[model samples]
Target chain A: MKRALRLRPKGLEKGRPETKPTNDAERRQLMTAEGEVRGELRRLRARLPQVTGALAASADGLVLASETDEAKEAEHVAALTAAALGVALRLTEATGQGGFRELLIRGESGYVATYAAGPTAVLTLLAEPRINVGRLHLEARRSGARIGELIRGALERPALVPRKPNRPPSLAGP
Target chain B: MANTETALKEATTAIEGAVGAALVDYTSGMALGTIGGGKDLDLNVAAAGNTDVVRAKVRTMELLGMQDEIEDILITLGTQYHLIRLLKGRNHSGLFLYLALDKQRANLAMARHQLKRIEADLEV
Candidate 1:
């Protein structure tokens, strides 16, 4: 079940081969950060009467942590958030808007919301249609900021590693 | 049953001074169908870009604690009126209909009414 829940960044795999080797370690750090964010999400859900679920995901659509029972649904939401983020960023830039902030979709059953978490991640929440939008935004914006910091820290840690000199090409071909 | 492509075509022809119309998936930022766009206005780009406007308004509503559903979002340029109508049907979730109209020749109220009618007849 855990394996099934691992979020894969299918959209970015093609251009990021160099980041592969450190994936395991980076994933560990991210998971730790995610754990903290998950705790925050849980608290937010507990305080808000209408929130049904919450998730933190990377900008590329990898799920960091989720506070929902339906893992598959969370995965799909995260991917969609990433896709939405792409267009949102472009829209803001093109229109002279400051930055990509948040997105909300209202349906007959409920509301789906996404907030920018720093530069590296996003926070998505699902809520009952009757939920208080003001309170949801207040708590969510705070939580999203913290999660963003955590993720940004995790991403920056890897940069501190000492770089090894490029190896000389082997003279003999096997 | 009416389909997305037919509905878009009908939107451009039925609405006066319509430059283009499109069915867009806000989730994927992709246009499912488009009609009537040319060199000055690109329906695909407009469709994709408007997803943000829809998203921003929704977020603002959440922040403002407003509970009312959005009927439609209207953007008026010097020569154009961009109308975005969110699809409320079960299967049409996350999708919206976007129509760009020439301001001089289009009747805003009637265009909105027609778009609403078109939205009801649209099948995904």
Candidate 2:
């Protein structure tokens, strides 16, 4: 945000509270971005009744906004989502399956699905056991992308640019 | 598709000079299935020990910000070859196939070739 706002002079370091959007207009803008993301989650629920709950978090797993009944558990869910993400990213890379786009995990009781909202955010959905997975994916992917945009807007971050995939420099590095 | 039991059996029985083989879940360091290890080889111990090797490599990749995944790792000793092949695809994430062979009698190239073939058919 500090970078995006250009409030601080060049070479100014971190830890300045003034860098935050403290002005009323700036704060409203940030809230609106957050509101839009949460709204998208709700709209997704209405479209796909199978989606019981959903939350959008940063890639590091900090919850930006959520629309889930299990409010108290949201923290743990985001943390675990991040952990699962680490494994999923590695799993995809290891398989030469390209970059991770989404992940689906089905338990006997229900499904825990996650999608890449953007380069820096993730969308995780909790669904009932009887949910239509295909429909869920269809709806969630769009919502994930929308939420990613809102998040990037709120944070004033630039869009993700695909980078050239680089192979490991050497296997003997360790 | 190959099940754990049959896969272990095949790797041990078919891979020339293979003393032991195990389908290891590296996340838990548990040998889900094992075959052909006696007191000298200790497939269970090898499975757990090799988990460290896999983990170290994974961490190194992260630190280096590498965009590639490991296909397999080979370690050579005076009289043995330790092969650890990471399972690919969605279903078998966090799992690896471990095989121990008598280096003197085992053909490293052929061993890798056979491992790749078996890995393709392995379902778990």
Please tell me which predicted candidate would have the highest lDDT against the true structure. Answer: 1
Clashing pairs in 2: none
**What would the per-residue lDDT of candidate 2 be over residues A1-174, giving only the tens digit for each residue?**
111101123244245432232333433433456678888988998986767888887555667678898777777899899788868766766786765688899898889999987666678999887565545666777788787678666655322333333221110111
Q: Looking at the true structure's interface, with contacts defined as alpha carbon pairs within 8 Å between chains A and B, what fraction does model 1 recover? A: 0.00
Leading candidate by TM-score: 1
- Tens-digit per-residue lDDT, A110-131, candidate 1: 9999987775578899999766
- Per model, state how many residue pairs clash: 0, 0
Clashing pairs in 1: none
**iRMSD, per candidate, in listed order:** 10.7, 16.1
Instruction: Assess every candidate by TM-score.
Output: 0.47, 0.43
DockQ of each: 0.02, 0.02
lDDT of 1 by residue, B22-120 (tens): 998776566788898898987766765687678778889999999888889999999999999999977988888999999999999999999999999
Alpha-carbon RMSD, each predicted model: 13.0, 18.3
What C-alpha lDDT do the candidate models reach, one value each?
Answer: 0.76, 0.74
